[model samples]
Target: MPNLSTTYLGVPLKSPLVVAASSISSHVDRVQMAESAGAGALVIRSLFEEQIQLDSMQLDEFLAAGSDSFSEATSFFPKIEHGGSKEHLMWVEKTRKAVSMPIFASLNAVSPGAWVTYAKQLARTGVNGLEVNLYSVPTDMGKSGSDIEKALYEVIESIKAEVALPVAVKLSPYYTSPANVIKQLEQHGAGAVVLFNRFLQPDIDPDTETLVNEMVLSNPAELRVPLRWAALLYGRTRLDLAVNTGVHTGRDAIKALLAGATVVQVASTLLQNGIPYLSTMLLDIQNWMDERGYKSLDDFRGKVSQKHCDDPFAFERAQYVKLLSSIH
Candidate 1:
């Protein structure tokens, strides 16, 4: 069997297939199943700052609603303390204890202070690492791309200063210059970078004139974006690259590795198929490697990247032009 072992953010993984942060990690049994199914590591569902804030607000409202009803009822609440992120912290720690594989906690926050505070708390959850989700849709017209990048750097710097765990930044693909932003992240102490963060876009019900929000899982076709970026960034930086979104099978994972990704994080495929499907993907990779006579991932990893590929512009616009010309 070909050696599938690889490392990410300095943490060794038996395989390169990582479970991306999603609802899949909500169940402890599923997490253990992922480990059994051959996942290298798992990133727990993110602890959103907005969710914590909303919970705190709801609790405050409930506590104050009946406080003014009567003097005796003022203490009726029993001085209960708001859980805040206590439940999420406990969940992360519980999941960590349930499996022997590396468990990485994810955090999504809006402010620098919140990022640092939550990162510190998550670092105490016995997780092997942290994945910071920089997910946001910029609606403010006044904010320039540089401003957004600056805020990201500040948050990264703050979290790195406050926490001891390795940090992986899950970046938004909409950046003006993703490579430049990635370089900045490296300078600010990010150990790794997830190629792209999938954003959920709301749809409109034209007949009812209402907004509809639904979860749409990724498909294999979505792999191209990260694939190109991974190939482009292979030899450009020292940061580990994790290709996420659109990886559905063993060949997809191999494609990522060939493009120089340190590992491939999958969630949609597992959710759409089944947890056991992870082992199938790994088996597919192993079979393909054996057939190709590749003993280890490094044997051909980055072999097709822009830095090493025969066609240096394969991931560039020249290829795009060639494809269009060929279409005619």
Candidate 2:
């Protein structure tokens, strides 16, 4: 059997396939199942401060809307149980006790003080590491791109100051220059960088004249974006790069490693398929390695990356233009 062992953020993993933060971590049994099914690590569902605040705001709006139209509406709703960071901290601790694999707690979109406070509390849970989901949406017209990047740096620095756990920042791909962001994060002591965070885009319902706000699982084609960037960034920085946002198969995972990704994170794929399916993906990757006579993941990890590939320009826009022109 080929050696699938690899390390991310200085933490050793059995394979490069990591279970991304999602509802799969909600149950202790499920997390254990993932580990048994061959996951490298598990990132618990995020403690999303912004998501909690959004829920609160919507609740207030609901009460206000009903206060005037229906007097009984105010009394009908149940008390909001946002579960706050305290509840999340307890749950993460429980999960940590249940599993032997490296457990990472996610803290997303937190306030200034909450970043330090929650980060400290989470680190106390005995998790192996932390994943900071830097969910930045550039909606504010006044906030320049530089302002957003600076805020991200401060967030990481605050968390680092509060905790000793290895931390990885999950970033959005919309940044003006993602490589620069990674360089800054490396300087700020980030152990790893999860390539891209997927944003929930709101759709419109023309018939109802309302919005369509729901989560959509990613498809395999979405892997291209991170694949390109990962290959381009392979030898450019010292930061560990984690490819996410469209990896769904064993072949997909292999592609990421070939492009120099330290690891590949999956959430939607597990959700769409069964959790046991993880073992299948791992088996497929193992078969590929055996056929290629690759003894370890590092044997050909970056073989196809820009640094080692025959054509470095294959990852750039110049190649993209040439391919299109050649087609006609």
Best by TM-score: 1
Clashing pairs in 2: none
Off by over 4 Å in 1: 68-71
lDDT value for model 1: 0.94
Cα lDDT for residue 265, candidate 1: 98
Query: Each candidate: how many clashes?
Result: 0, 0
TM-score, prediction 2: 0.90
On lDDT, the candidate that comes out on top is 1
- Model 1: ten consecutive residues of lowest lDDT: 68-77
Clashing pairs in 1: none
Give RMSD (Å) of candidate 2 vs. truth: 3.7
- lDDT tens per residue, model 2, 1-328: 9998888888889988899999999999999999999999999999888766777788678778877787786677676554556778899999999988889999876467878777888999999999998875678999899988898899899889879999999989888788899999999989999988888899999999999999999999999999988998998888888999899999999999999999999999999898999999999999999999999998988888899999988887738776788985
lDDT of 1 at 297: 92
Q: What lDDT does candidate 1 reach at residue 59?
A: 84
Q: In angstroms, give how far residue 52 of model 2 lies from its true place.
A: 4.5
